[model samples]
Target: MCNSNSLSPVWRELKRLQSTDELFEILSPQSFKWNIGKGTQILFWYDIWVGVSKLRDQFPALFRLSGKKNEHIADMVIFSENGLMWWDIGILFPLNEYEDLQYQMLMSLLRNFKVDLYKEDEVQWTHSLEKVSSVAEGVRVMVKSHIDFEFDRVKVVWNKLVPSKISTFHWLAIQGGIPVKEVLSYRNCLNNSSDDKCAWCLDHIESIDHILLHYSWSHKVWTGLFKWWNIFWVVPSNVLEFSVDWSNGMGIKAEKVWKLIGSATFWAIWLARNEVIFNGSYTCWAVIVSRIKLKVFQWLVNAKVCESFQLYVWSDHPWLLLQSPSFDMF
Candidate 1:
């Protein structure tokens, strides 16, 4: 009855959209609920129609014993000659004492439920009185549920000295929205790649933290920067924590320039990663460190963060700009 080549354009687009994880995560129990009618369209066990959680999660023992794991709600209900509705759940084996107790609980939960066999099921938006879903509503729910970062990172990433693109990248990186190998794997987009290993190290999975913070190449770049500032440093677990740690450690006078340098360091390491992966050209960590220093110097001079200073002085004694009373303009 159906062929992929003969699918309507809208239907094809819908199919493509269904494969994305964003839709899957957004349509969770917190934001959306099913208004049961006939229940023919809803999965009986896997869907969150019966209660706050999925039936499989709520009745794990019963779910494990179920033979008809993929049965629909309508299929699990039997209609008697007297117009009585009864469960027809297909269990593979008899329940033990604990599972029998769970079964009793499940039956009690479903005792007062009624199903209308004639009407179709509908998805209702939990957040709205109208029961209609909108992208704005979905985004609001997602942000409220998911975001748990400190507000200080926002100010750090949006520094006047950093380029807008780099600032945006840092923001995305902090949110785990960057399309690194680990993220692409999570989105099921890394079909061609054998594994999500770091391009530079080829040892660990290439998460944002591994590539930008933990890997030897990126670690060396951070170490070089710390040595340049003559500060003892311990790397944090992830980008956001690193930003907060770095900010908290810096003095009031050094914070602005240090934030700029931090942003430049992340950008340079990312560029080096892309160079290896896309251009098939490899640059060492020492070169990446040099690039970060040069790029930060350029950003400072162009942004007029302070009076123009010689590149040699920046490369050799960069902390002088932060420590010197004459360069207090920063």
Candidate 2:
């Protein structure tokens, strides 16, 4: 059998295999590849022969409705007295609604690749990189696939120049994962009405955003820091938004310094917030601003972005220090 009708014999044998068959288990990994030179060995439906991915994974909807779900490419290709004839499985399967029309488009895509009839079809392992695959790199790619990590602000949080604890705190604050009063209330961690109010402002719910950016006390801290930098920009509404967009429209060196500034500001705000909440201490705006100044300088010096600025000078004229010709020693 060398035509479409020959698929019935092969389909019968595949159906007879038990559930624990090793052949089925061999395809368990999430990736595989096919070198479809002759297209004789690759299964058209069950194998990841086309689309650089498994047809089962890429087009699950079409695969479920397909009648010849286990047919090989050779079984569907007709080599008659007249030459080779390509037969799409649409004739054997009845697809309803949009799938009926979509099947033709899919078939056209399959027809585009030129099949070399001389070379034998070979199976290959598909990995993320074209280089030799290592278990460590493979695990890294696999772990990354499961995370919804699309945020650009992550660079600011995981900056190698900053302290690890400070970076972690900034990451948590940006993600709203910190156990602030508002979040605790939402999670039912707070039991009394007294725990619902902001520790610093005592006006509204103490959300992470509110405590970090919007509260009257914290507003002064952010604005004063911006004033110290001589940047006349409007403050962003949330920590994530601020971290991602705050350094835009600056040169490369300036942006690096600005990112350190943002990270340091977040760490300082969190430290001040915790002090007021847990220690019953009042951290004034000026003190917080000064902490930010010192923190930024410490991180920047360690970052090696700028080499020759004295601490007193950076504190007095922060933006001027960044603008000085000596700052070009990045």
Leading candidate by TM-score: 1
Residue-level lDDT tens digits of model 1 in 1-330: 011233346433432333124443444353446777897767787667776778877987787677666666888888889989988667778889999999889888777666788887776657654665455654576587673323445675787767799999988887778889867854558763335668888866688999899988788889988888788778978787787666655654577777778888888888888998999898888888888888888877786654564778789887656565645655
> Which residue segments of model 2 deviate by more than 4 Å?
1-151, 249-253, 304-309, 323-329
Candidate 1 stretches greater than 4 Å from native = 1-152, 249-253, 305-309, 323-326
List model 2 lDDT by residue over 1-330, tens digit each. Answer: 111222245332322221112322222233445666777777675566666556656665676565555567766666668665565553445677788666777777777755667876654435446533344544465466553323355665676777888888888886668888856754457665246678876766688888888888878987897677666666677776666665553433477677677778877888888888889998778988888888778776775655545788888866667776656764
RMSD of each: 10.9, 18.8
| Residue 219 displacement (Å), model 2 | 0.9
lDDT measured at residue 173 in model 2 versus the true structure, 0 to 100: 80
Q: TM-score each candidate.
A: 0.55, 0.51
